[model samples]
Target: MTTEQLTIFAILAITLGLFVWGRWRYDIVALLSLLAVGLFGLIPPQEMFAGLGHPAVITVAAVLVVSRGLLNAGLVDTLARHLTRVGEQPWIQVATLTSIVALSSGFINNVGALALFMPVAIWMSRKGGSSPSLLLMPLAFGSLLGGMLTMIGTPPNIIIATYRQESGGTPFGMFDFLPVGAAVTLAGLLFLSLIGWRLTPKRKEEQDTSKDLFEISAYLTELRVPKECKFAGRTLHDLMAAVKDDADMSVVGLVRSGKRKALPSIFEVLQEEDILLVESDSDSLKTLLDVTSLVLAAGEDQDQDQDEEKKKKKAGEWNLTEAIITHKSILVGKTTSALSVRERYGLNVLAVARQGHRLRERLGKLRLEAGDVLLVQGQEESLQSTLNELGCLPLASRGLRIGKPHKVLLSGGIFTVALALIALELLSATTALVGAALAMVMTGLVAKDEVYDSVDMPVIILLAAMLPVGQALETTGASDLIAQALLEIARSASPAIVLALLMTAVMLLSNLINNAAAAVIAAPIAIKMAQGMEASADPFLMTVAIGASCAFLTPIGHQSNALVMVPGGYRFGDYWRLGLPLSVLVLVVGVPMILWFWPL
Candidate 1:
């Protein structure tokens, strides 16, 4: 290998290793790799931040904002509520949910689209008297299927379109991916709803016992203080023994004189009518109330009226919620208390949940980390805004609101016009997308703030950093070298075998590295392979797109998989059971779909 190739490989390997280990954030890893390339003199210092201005990066960010706007407008939720009425049958429910998700993902951000419908699917499973595990895998897969349809539905599609523009000076139109993507999506959804969901292991069935997996059940209940209660004068620690003795109850906070206390210490003196935030089941709670000299309140409401009143006076009321921080987040290290989150951003750190283990005391003192779930309560508007600003993802489903569902036709019309304009080669894909985004803003379908709010900064940063790296790889003949090796290995194989092998290779690479990175490296190789075979490039390119996206075999392969891991209570080994077959199914169906549509 050449020195440049060796350097590029080393950087890519280190980046991928760090990403898989998940010790450092992904955007940080990408940025560090960019710096490494610069230090190695592979890329000029002047071009270090050029990826930020790349069309792919710009398009991805714009799409995120647009998707967020649509979500905020409630377009998906309106559709989701109706979609859940498909049927009582498990396969039918799964099929309907999957089909809806796939279709929705075609027009908006697939992740956002999935987020909108996940709650609906969860509710549907409950109503149908089944486990959420039966439906979530299909939901995620459906989102992936839908993302392949439109240009802005997924990052890979955006990257491929930009790559096309960079290479050929004319980008693929908005609907260019639909012919192949639609075919693959339909077949895959059919397989998942019918056969793929059945392959899931029985252990996944057991995990559905705890609907809210953050263990909130252990942190809510009734508490009392009697007239002769000596514990009234004692500190919070004096009551610690009583809490331990009561297995079902935990002390969340104190409510005194119809007022909420903020982060009370162990030595804080308790008074009469000071309610302790205890968590326990009905029996344990009754047992504790009987033993203690205190009488339980008639209503088991945790928050006092005065606390509610105070919250009402504020811009928005403070409410508790559980959320997980993403791997690419910026607010992973600092604690909410340390950051003065409440003071600065009007958010209070109520509790922190790390890997299913709940930390009761010193909740704010605990440092935050990626995958750490937090139970936070604060002013509604500020807290939601802060969560977005802090990069924390709410575990629960949020109701999406578009400005007006009444404007659905107008919103749809504007985007349709943009697509048509692009289809007719009247405007570049990037320009057309930007124009659609502008129309959405102008029509008030999305607000000004909504435009920037949807974009994930970390994802944008990662894309920007990796673009130059991809360019360097292609410029160094490394992508060519990798492609040549694959061709040589498949020299004796038939075209069908070669296509399958290429798909498998790309699929494996996506599992091992970033999917976008895999596509960048493999896309050119596919074009070269088609040239060598004296065939059309469209089939090969489409094959790479399909293969690069079907990374379900491992949790680390796709962010969607990582997202469902703890939420679904799945073990590391559980994914391969369903994922492997799904990947195989995609390969089986995708090959014929590509050949038939692109016609090599």
Candidate 2:
């Protein structure tokens, strides 16, 4: 190998290692690897940040902004609320939920689509008397399928189209992905609804409180403070000390002489026969009872005022909701006490769950992370606005608000016109989407101030920084070197065998790195592979595009997978169970479809 190729390979190896290690953010690791390229004088200094202005980058950013506009206008929310009525059977609910999410993913960013529909899936699981695991994984996989339908649905498709253009071919049009994409999506959807869901682990049994969004029966319990209890005279805050120091729980309510306090003060003093409505998140329930001398008791009805007028005045007095923290959540990386949730918003952080288990740390000191589901207690009046500002997605099905008719019309209208222009070849994808995004701001469909916030900066940076790195691989002939070595192993085989091999390799790599990165690095090698076979590059290019999107094996593969992990209660090993079969099915179903459509 040449010196430049060696340097590129070294950078690639280290970059891949850091990605798998996950010690730093993907954006940060990508930025550093990009600088390493510059320090080695690999590329011209002028081209180092050229990726930032690439059409693919611009299109990605524009799509994200457009997604936010749709969300702000409540288009997806309205559709999802109506879509959940597709019968209550597990197979029907799974089929309906995944189908709706896939269709939505075709129009919007996959993460945004999954975010809006995931709550619906959770609600369906609760309503259908099944564990959420069955629906959540299918929903995540369905978003991946939907992304294949349109070029604008995923970053890999856009990047692959750009590569096609640079290779002297007509760039793929907006609907070019639809023929093979739709076929693959349909087959995958059928498999998931009928057979794939059975592979998903049923992580938890349905709780008795069927209406609750998340299963937390083990996290919640009732205890009675007796006269013989040594801590009777002590404050509730003091009683909290008797519980594990690190574990998190809350006294959500209390009963004193048949009068219940919805939110008992932490400073409230414990008394004889006081029924403490406690929530313990740890496995220390038995230990807590033994240490505090508290006895288990049945909870009583907390029906408040009988006065109709008084009830009307306090219509939203107390309510409980489950909220999942988004990547954009302002609450990320901070403690609830640090934000003073109670003091600032009249909300209580009753409990928090991470990675399919309730956290055992003290809630006050437990720092927040993206994907942590929190059971929040607050007044129903201001709950929606508070969660919005905090960037939390409430799991309640009714959290979505249908916008004014005009706003919805304008939001959907702007996007549809943009797509029409792209399909008609009147405008490039970048130009059309950027125009639509700006129009959203002008039309009041999206607030101008929040436009930048709506864009996913980390993904943007990762894509932009890695673009030049991918270019460097092709320029240095590193991708060709790698592709040729594989070809030598399959020199006597048919092009179809090579195609399947190439897709499988990229699919595995994507499970380790970001899908867009996988696409960027693999695009050139695919062209080389097609050239070796003396066949059309379109088939190979499509293989890489679809392969990159098949990040179903690992939680870190795609944001959609990671987003559903905790909510679905899936462990790291759980993914391959469902993902393995779906991937094999995609290969079996996609190769024939690609060759038929693109003519290898």
Candidate 3:
């Protein structure tokens, strides 16, 4: 190998090592790799950052924003409503949920489809008394399988299509992937719904109880009805009814003039300065505050100055933080009401958790203890400072935004139009998606501020950063050298065997690196191998497409897998138990389908 090829190979080796290390964020690793290549002069400095504006990067960002718009329009809630009508049997639920995820992923981004359905799968698991692990792994895997069915389903397919077009051949049409992709998807889905789910670890269900499932609900705290609040005139029952379908909170008690009423009557009308004790998760707290127009109570004292300042700040400017009460916390033995958390710290205690146990007492009256988890809300800077002063360690966030269901039709329609544009070849995928995203903002389906938050920056960075590295591989002749070696190995084997081996190699590489990067590197090699053997390039390219999308052996292989890890309580080793068999099934089934559909 030339010096440049050697340098590229060494850089790639370290990059892959960092990816598997899981110490640093993948995007950071990718960015460092991009900079390394630039400094080494492997890639020209002028073109080093060009990947950021590539069509694939733009398309990925646009798709993510569109997915968030669909989510904000309550698309998942609509699906959940129908899902409840499906039979409650575990196997049946798995089949139904996985089927929906897979089908949706075929058209939309696979990670977005998985995110939309993850909660539904968890709910189904809870309702059926099954381990979420059993359902989640299948749902994640199904999303991966579904991505193979269309050009836009996954980034790898888009990369492969672009590669084919650049090689002086007509780009693969949207449905060209359907035949082999469908076959592989069918086989993989069958394995997941039937045999694969059975292989998942049941540690979650066996070790965790229903009480642990309700841990997220422990973040509830009380807010006082201000004199100007609209909810002051409404009865407790009426207020509950108003937010029943959307907000995941309930009125548990009432406090009038510093005295607590543990079980206030449903018909009791809320009064000015009356503290309505509410139970809600962290996510719904902001919505609850907005809907009721109630001010967060610090204590018996109503600070007019603080309330006015809070009212001036935009709703989205506030931050919700989850912190663990440490042993040295001054408020450990005191209740929220007694400690006057809001009065003392200028932070609102939105919810509290002590181990896995539920606090049945009033939120304000419940005594704080060391090791308790508190969901506190305030300005970002103040919240962090308060956590430090109170001796608490912050935890990862958990909550969902409650959005308008009325906008579902509009958002879904816009998304459909974009898909139609791509299908009819009226617009390029990136242009169509960008147009749809802009339309979503224009129609108020997604808010202006939320557009930036909707795009997955890490994913965008990872894709953009890896593109230049992939190009460097091609320019250095490393891809050609690898392809020649593979061709030599396949010379003694049949063409079908060669196709299967090529796919198997790519599949292994995909499991270790980003699937899009794998596709970019492997596409050229597949093309080179086909040319060397004087065989059809179509089958070889199809093999690369299948291999890149079948990254099931490890969670790091695909974002869909990483998305399910924490929620499903999965370990690093948990994936291969189910993923291994499904991967083997893909190779066993995908090769023949590719050959049969596009002969060598």
Candidate 4:
């Protein structure tokens, strides 16, 4: 009823609307909300930016760096070895795949862990002739489940743990999440591997050779420009204007006499002996040839080149491969032209595939997103390094490799020591992980230039920006008002039912917004709700942590879900089939587990 309460509520409502609308990135929206609160004098002006240096923010950045170090060390590669031989049945395959991803997630960033295993899962599905839809959803959910087991596994745990310290309690130790996190993970994994996978819609079978993930491979053709050709002296822009309306193709690249120009400008003038990389079907190719009098280059081998591209791919040589962009990828919001990807990374985006359909017509201007599979051309080594920097994962069937032996031993040693410090309570998590991340760079487990690149900045910004808003809620008594409302809704209910209601609210909020933001917003209300019930806040806080992590209902809920969308060939509706039941299972399991460990 107060002015401050109404102001904060209005701001939060708009924030939630923007998040669910997804018209803009979450970090940007958070920053805007931060500005709104400050301009309205919600929090102290001096304290408006204090959340930037918050321990939770720092720990998240450090964890991302540490995860990159482990990823670079090839730990996943070591675990991913011989996955195809694990099983043939769907249950066995799902169990093996989800187990590996889940275990990896407990130690590293769940999104990073999912990224590492995605290729392996895809390879297994194709090799065993099973529908990828059956395995990818399970693998994605497993990553979410796995992250619950450790403080650093997901950002929500870190946020809740740090909030505990901020609220006059000691920060949770690293392994404090293990008991509850592990139980939920076990139950969720069992459901996914056994019965959950059956609920997923089968997109296609691996045995169905008649179908393909993308039909663009047959459309790529190389044509040589003859001196007598009419379009020899004209720019590709002109040539495209002539044939583009009739053909769904683009000039992806051009090879000169001995030099290759990847992603040439549309205005670049063409010359004789130029090799034009045309993306078109047989009919389109003929039409183009007829219109321009361009002849097929002698060395141009479409069938052999595409089919055998993977076999001939090497890190040091120019080749073609498919890479999936992660949500953390710098290229997520920008177009290829803006980033100059070809010049910066020595690669070209030949085409893009979204949810199993090809979109190759305007690659140069396409704004990329997480889980988008890109048909890229570049040297394998350059691509390996660049994609690592760009937060992309090359498909496993392409045979790209990860991990460096000497760096592995060094980085592994550093990470182990950090975890030991946290477990022994010798050093705070922020200090230990920050020191370990520096060690990773110093010891060469991660590159010096890549030190900051490994950190997911948008996520850091989201956490930093939202913390103050959460503080504003508690500081202004808005949290208490909300908690009072919740208490009335659950009037006469036991503490257990109240806990379940809190978790359900958090879960629904998380599915609509970033999980970290969900935690930041819910933490204060959870504490207030506990105080209203004259119960301990520990259980309620822990409930926030658990509920925030169960963002299985929508792809927009978590990066792990979105990361698997395109590869799994899933649409918006597909997530709920398995996610809804798994979410119920998490609640049924997690509520009891939290009550046992941190009683109200």
What digit string (tens of lDDT, one per residue) describes model 4 on residues 1-600? 899999999999999999999989999999999999999999999999999999999999999999988888876677777676787788998999898888889889998888787777777776677777888889999999999999998999999998777767898889899999999999999999889999987877422412345556567678888988888888887887787556556676677766666557777899998888777767778888888788987763544443343343443356566788876678887887689775577676767887677775566567887778887766655667777777777875344344433456677789999999999999999999999999888878888887787888889999999999999999889999999999999999877788899999999999999999999999999989888988878889999999999999899999888878877888899999899999999999999999999987
User: Positional deviation of 535 in candidate 2, in angstroms?
Assistant: 3.1
Cα error, candidate 1, residue 93 (Å) = 2.0
The clash count for each model shown is 11, 1, 1, 2
Please give the lDDT score for candidate 4: 0.84
User: How far in Å is the alpha carbon of 80 misplaced in model 2?
Assistant: 1.3
Q: Estimate each model's TM-score.
A: 0.80, 0.85, 0.72, 0.87
* Predicted candidate 3 versus true structure: per-residue lDDT over 1-600, tens digit per residue: 899989988998899899878677778899999999999999899989998898878887887788768867876557655775576676787788888888888877787787667656665666666667778889999999999998878888877777777667877777789999999998888878778888887755343622233353344467888887777878886776666455666554467876655446667888898987676766667877777677788853434423432343334455554555644467878887687665566666656655433344456667887656676665544665577667665543333222236677888889889888887988888789899999988988778987986676777888889889888888888878888898788779988789889888888888887888788768878888878887778888889999999889898888778666655667889899998888889989998899899997
lDDT of 1 by residue, 215-272 (tens): 5544465466766787878876566556444433444456777666543555677888
Worst 10 residues of 4 by lDDT: 205-214
Ten-residue segment with the worst summed lDDT in candidate 2? Answer: 301-310
Residue 215 miss distance in model 3 (angstroms)? 6.2
Off by over 4 Å in 4: 205-212, 215-279, 291-318, 326-348, 360-371, 388-391, 399-406
Clashing pairs in 4: 315-380, 315-381
lDDT of each: 0.71, 0.84, 0.75, 0.84
In candidate 1, where is summed lDDT lowest over 10 consecutive residues? Answer: 395-404
